[model samples]
Target chain A: MSSPFSSLHVVDLSGSIAGNYCSRLFLDFGAQVTLAEPENGASVRHVPPFDKDRRSLAFHHLNTGKRVVDLPKSKAELADLVAGADVAIVPQGFKDEIAKLAGDRCVCVEVSAFGADGPYAGWQANEMVHQALSGMMSNNGEPGREPLYGVGNRASYAGGVAAYITAMVGLFTREDDGQGQKASVDVAETAAAMCFPYVLQYFYNGTNRRRGDQDIPAGQVLCEGTWVCIWIYPHRFAAMCKALGLSQLIDDPRFAQVADRVKNWAEMFDIIQDHVRDEDAEDVVSRLQEAQVISACAYRPSELLENPHLAARQYWDGPDAQGLPRLGAPFRLSRMPRSRVNEVTE
Target chain B: MLPFENIRVVELTTAWAGPMAGRILAHFGADVTHIESPTRTNTWRTNKGAPSPVNYPDFDPGERRWDRVFLFNSQNVNKRSLAIDLKAEGGVETVRDLVLQSDVLICNFRPGMLRRLALDYESLSKHKPEIIVAEMPAFGLEGPHSSYAALGPTMEMAAGMSAAIAYHDGKPTVTGPSYLDPIGGFNAAAAIATALYHRRKTGLGQHIEVSQVEAAMQFIGPEILHAAVEGKDTKPDGNRVAHAAPHNAFPAQGEDEWVVIAAQTDAQWQALCAEMGQAELAGDPRFADVGSRKANEDALERIIADWTGAFDKHELAAKLQSAGVIAAPVNTPHDLAHSDYLRARGFYAEITHPVAGTHPHPGLPFHLERAPGDYRRSAPAFGADNAHLLGEVLGFDSERIDAMVRSRTIADAPNKEA
Candidate 1:
């Protein structure tokens, strides 16, 4: 039941989402992660949504399963501390200085808004800027309006995921050759990497796909008292027609082919909407499931809390420093034991 | 030499998420053998599941349409494909033999489907005690929704990600791209790598399960934490941070061109004002500090937009960045496809697939100076490695391989129905 990274030690000098989460994943793998915070605590600790007692939940979720230490005030002290570490995740701002401090045994992972040597590397950036810099905002949210970033800090989270993978790759390399190498991630590039073959499509054909509206009336619509999303492929559309007692609609010339359905999508949606207007949400869901249609009920956050599936899986971890329920491990390993230090961020 | 040169992976997966995980493992130098049923071809290879342009290299799928499918081809590089029918008489033994020789096994079948196939972790572990099984189920294995089927969009909704990502005043929506799929894939790859590391040390294998729903939650961790801690629900804030002023995508000259400018700190604000030739604005009471500027955000945006409207987004971003103010163009495919920055870093590799010809593909997200990943091999054709895998790796004689092929346990093409 020993964790994968049980033998490793880490010094984390990352501030915001990306570097911090990278180190946190290492912590989850049982690496002895030392969160090196400034004297006043990390910037996330001071961000909003504070409780009546002024504790930040962002910090509560991010700083679990790791011990905190005051970042060394001087270069020599920093060097002394990093000398014993197997990995050091440093922010772009302090990458150079930290790289010099990290010993040969330690791998230095630099996380940045752009990259280490890009022209935009020196510019200050947040999650939104990165979303824009990448093409994420272009294909997200409502079309024609100002581009919108997603609700959460997606760019930073993606950057963190990239950094963690890079670190693991580095560890894998080191395991063979006994050489811990340097790795880095550009937040913008990381976001772009997740983008569907958009760039490839653009390169192949002259098409710049724009952001479509989130609630495309045709794709997601209200069925009775519940929101349900439908991915209407030709096969699924036929099945949906059967489920809604509109079997004849499948043969209708206006909705027969994919192009015809696209042209008359509004009418087709209305017909489907009318049929489900009075049906129970659960009934609609069951009918669609039975018919093998590509459909899902739009669940809200509160509804997710009550989902019998999530409850049975026990996905939520304990109340951390701010007494907030945090998500447990992103993945589970049957034999590898998870962290038991639930009340961290001290 | 590649970092994962010694690693071997047996991929039993379908669609984007699972294939993407196998693709990454291949990129990292794992000897991945993709096992698909010839009778039940992966959905991505049939019909128009392939991505644009490359799917039809000369604007045609030619003779081997499945091999040319861009979606499957793009993610299946550097891997061998083995088409084995699990339902066939000798199919189970074919897979079991491959499993015995593999280091890691991966699958994304619905919760109980693998167990029904008698290839679940428990069943596989009994045969190969050192096998690392990475299971990526849509909802997860032991849940009420576990038995329910899903694509990325549905899983996103089930995970509450769609709700959180909606516009401030709009309904929750789905991304054009399945955003959570790649994230889940990346997590799966990382988990397998870590598990491999652990196995190397302890000589034991473990069952690793990565739920698409759970992995999606990591992106919205702060919001969930806030709601759980302070009973405060976080509303969507489109392109704007609470404390950062001038933090939005401002219009530029071209049709959809825009630039994001964020003056997070006082110096950045001063620099932005100076770059816009409105140094006097920095001294204005309404825009003096973070709090005041946030309060007067509308007015600030108007003034900033007026200046930004005259120049192209990329050009303006450069000017702002030179002055130490935060700025970047809201780039689309057009801009990204021809990016000088990406080119300078060698971010894109020109990979030549047999059917797709040559095209630019994204390199690894991170750079490893010493032992970088190798993208030498193109995606395998349907059951391309059947001869080599069965004859060489399994040490099977030609007669045995021929017999399996004759019985339809091995296939060179998808089933006639497919």
Candidate 2:
């Protein structure tokens, strides 16, 4: 089968996860990506968890299938590649340069920490700061405690996802007119969108959300042995009572209405917690699932890698240099087999 | 006026994840028609007579409450609604007929539920071999946990994100709201577009599977990959970076107000020190360089916090940024909503629905200089376009459509009190 991007070429001038991952998505689409890296290679190569050969596990996962080009390429050589390519994935700072080189046939996607031309455009930030600045950290920890930042550097990946989406829209537009466009995706805005209706509600009600801000306390509940984040939607009140075997609480006036339930959430959580303290997390989730209430076991990274469902769906790309499975594309396409370039070449 | 002018998407998704993808497609100009039935009205639309948390204008959901849900209105814009009870006798055939004319199909049902509905890829492809079907399951289609149901929070837990980002020394905690749902939706939309590109070239339609769990993993890919390679458990370290000093959210003057400051470079560190009126601190050996500063991050944090505590967050952010140090106020929802830059960029779209009234909706996240995404229509009311889509687009006669509607095979509202 012909790949979606067989004729497409990409100049990946991104060093970190955001731009690299965007290029990786293009690589998966069968576009030939030439990663432009510094003389010592990209900074990601030096990140932790290296193989015996000292190759970064992170770098191997994102860059294995793409070709690497040393940076400081002669302006003419770089311009030649950009002129013929379908996409140029660059850092926010390099937007104008890439745009000039791309001419009219190549789409330029600039992924930045703030945005391309914001007051904070020249500011330095990474995942941690982006999280803090985006109100994500504000809603992460317990009340009275200093806010927490989510594990894993997601701010950058969100930027990458935004870049990918923008690139696709650009390409789709180009499909008709043969004209390319420029796209700028700010990591902060992308992170904000991930929070969804919360952001919307805040705008509607003028309330800033905080950690433990829900009507019910949300966290890992230890069932017999597993940990799970049990969602407690107001409409599922009866189902939850049945699932937790607290059916008596269903008619209690303190928990009768959504507003009342929210007001008495702390006490209600205590009652529910006391009942489930001895049960297994998986067991509790099973009961909840039976009642059509939402719940699941809290997964560790190792557990996720070994998850049977992922194996069944072929969501891993085989062992990397260190004999660890690499995460596959976030989505799967049935007819066109996954590029599987690294699995074959590595 | 958008990129996907000729594309048509038939959505069978409910709740946040799948519908969000449909929303994006619609925003970009795809003719997205949401398939619903009285039996399976989306939970977002069937808010049980209660004042939905998603209500707009801060008003009670009046008589036509189904059409007033904030979630439904926000997510279903630029899309039409067609209520077809696939559970009805002829519903499957009707959808098959519709599928034959559409370019793409999307659903987020549990893995086998679609198969049970005879709406899985194999069955749908039988009708139109060149149809792109995007399936977003909470878990992947074939995993042991595939059958397990998950909302956004649970999936975040299962993806190890909850555990990884907890309070310092606390157990794993859920982030605010259903964080991964939108991310999953965005990825699904991108995947669908990519598949459409493939179909355009090869004249083949494929089944695209997006697992919310896997999508969450991609967010923390390098960290999880590290855990796999290093065989070590990772824990949440609040606001701490491996190589940056002064890399924490510091308290400001007001309650819960904060400014995040990061001084990664020596020049930035000097700038920060100068702004704090402690330029001499730049000469201190303990915090002289990135390595030393990271080694003594605790001390650096306290010192910075002490200076930051006396100032308002907004002022501190401005002062730091002007000094060439990276800083930004921890934006509340109001701050984001009222952002001058965001407003100036036309990032908020005000869409007016008859029942829900007018409200601000987020414009497209990506800025495409040439065909920017815009709202062409407000979200449709339940089954609002059943007659138009079935009769006009699908060429179904009014007699058949009316018969289906009378049989409870279609409805504009929930068949039972939802």
Candidate 3:
């Protein structure tokens, strides 16, 4: 069966991670995506996590399935590229020109840091700045320490996902009246959306939720030198006790009820930790799973490549043109198969 | 008309991921109806037979507290609710009829629950060939761990995100909030929209499955590639990226207040030095280039932190940004709730519910010029739309509805004893 977007055409001109990721989604579903890069190449090409040859892994990951072309210097040539596409992912600065060129029938998604006309529109910012301002970093680390940010390009990736959704929505709407429109996706706002229940908690009350040590019925425990995360709610307390050989604590008054467990979480956790400390991480996880308790070992990056579950699902896509492994399609469609990544010679 | 004005969605989902997909669709003007089971209530509504204090308004779990929990209310906005026991007599037939007329159905149950309930994609497609079904499982449907249970944190760990995002001490840590849930939610929405667009053209519908772990692994694709090409594991470097230096959060004047600064370019780094009244530092050999600054990062961080510690976080952020440096204050929840920027942009909608009261809720992240999304109403109360849906949409008579209610197939309140 043909891919869902097999006939769709997309032009990606932003050359940033956010723009590339949005276009990558289209490419994965068999869209014809052309990436226009500057003479110096896209900015992601210069970013880190380089291979042994100093080639950027970030660039290869983001630009694997798309066609690369030198950005046209002439306005007419650029306009021709946009005019031929059903969708154009443009930077904030180029939205007006691109939207006008694609005129009325193509969706133009303007991806930016703070958005086109906001107070911080012209301000210089990166992924870290976006995370900080979006209330995500504040609740990440221990309260007295410096706030933590995610490891990779989190904010940009989120903005890209939002932009992809925006493009799809615009196209779906255009089907009704055959008129396209311009959409704006702000990285800062997208980052804020990721910080969900905490943001809602503040609106519910007047308190700023702080990050601290783990509490009872949830959190990480050291099992044979590996930190395994386990999540348990009130409903699972009894089953967890029986599974972990803590059945003696099931009737303990201090831990009998949810409120009591919350009040005495520290003591309860210490006892739970003692029971699982000497067990192997995998064994502990298996035991927890057997009883319907959610648990997983915090795996290193290399470990995921060898993970049995992902391997069984055939979730890795490459050793492609660059001879490096990549993540497979984000979602599966029963009617269409995922397209393989091919070499795109510059 | 709004973007999704004519679309109708049936959401049989619990917890953050699935409901979030329905929430986004509802926000964009889809008529989304949530199917709830009184016997097995959504975990977000009650943590331990009662509402968690941190989830309810003002730490108060008043009467009908299920309707007031922020955890459920935040994600269920602009959607209607109906309580139906799928295990009851004629329940599966009622839902099958609804699906035959609706455009989509979304669920996040483990792999086989829908199959057991006779509501899986294969079962439903037999009735409505053009109905879209989106399922989000922690793992894929046929994987070895497909039937294994998972929550947000475990999903993150299984996906290799927690291992990559570690502190300076190199201990793996999960993000305070369950980050995978929202990411999975966004992916599900994107998939459904794509399928919808396809159906509009071909008159065909398909089953879409979003593996939550795989969706999250895409975010760290570069790290996975690094691990593959180099034949080595990538260790977590706290708050630092390989591309930039002086890229850490520093303390501000107030207690627990901090600001993040990232001088991504040489010009930005020089400008930051100038703003700190230490132009000589830009010329210093040890801090002259990205590589050199990274080599002497500890010293450079101390020098920058000393300069930033004297100013307020927000003021310092603005001052630095004005000087061409990328900077932003670490905003706590209180700061976010009272943010002037968010208010000016209309990112927060003042939503009022009869039970939960009026509050500022976060709105859509993106905007479409011609078809903007709106927050039409607050979240629904339990079974708030039973009469309207059963009578108007499903064409069930009042007597039949009453008989179903009497048989406990439908309920207006939660059933504590199943």
List model 3 lDDT by residue over B134-237, tens digit each: 98999888877788788887888888888788776666767746888999999999999889888988888889999998998888888888888777776677
DockQ of 2: 0.54
> In order, what is each prediction's RMSD in angstroms?
3.2, 3.4, 2.5
Model 2, A286-335: lDDT tens digits are 78888877888777777667665567767787675446677777777786
- Chain A TM-score of each model, in the order shown? 0.88, 0.84, 0.89
Off by more than 4 A, model 2: A46-57, A93-103, A202-213, A217-219, A223-226, A232-291, A312-314, A343-346, B52-54, B265-267, B280-299
Local distance difference test scores for all models: 0.77, 0.77, 0.84
Poorly placed runs, candidate 1 (over 4 Å): A47-54, A93-102, A205-207, A211-218, A223-226, A241-260, A271-287, B46-54, B230-232, B265-274, B277-307, B404-408, B415-417
List, for all models, the DockQ compared with the true complex.
Answer: 0.55, 0.54, 0.70
Clashing pairs in 2: A151-B165, A223-A279, A223-A280, A223-A281, A224-A279, A224-A280, A224-A281, A308-B143, A309-B143, A309-B144
RMSD versus native structure for model 3: 2.5
lDDT (tens digit, per residue) of candidate 1 on B62-137 = 6777777656776788899999888888788878788878888899877777678777779888977778989998
Q: Best candidate, lDDT-wise?
A: 3
Q: Give Cα distance to truth, residue A158, candidate 2, Å.
A: 2.0
lDDT comparison, 2 vs 3, better candidate = 3
Q: Is candidate 1 or candidate 2 better by TM-score?
A: 1
Give the TM-score comparing model 2 with the true structure, all chains together. Answer: 0.90
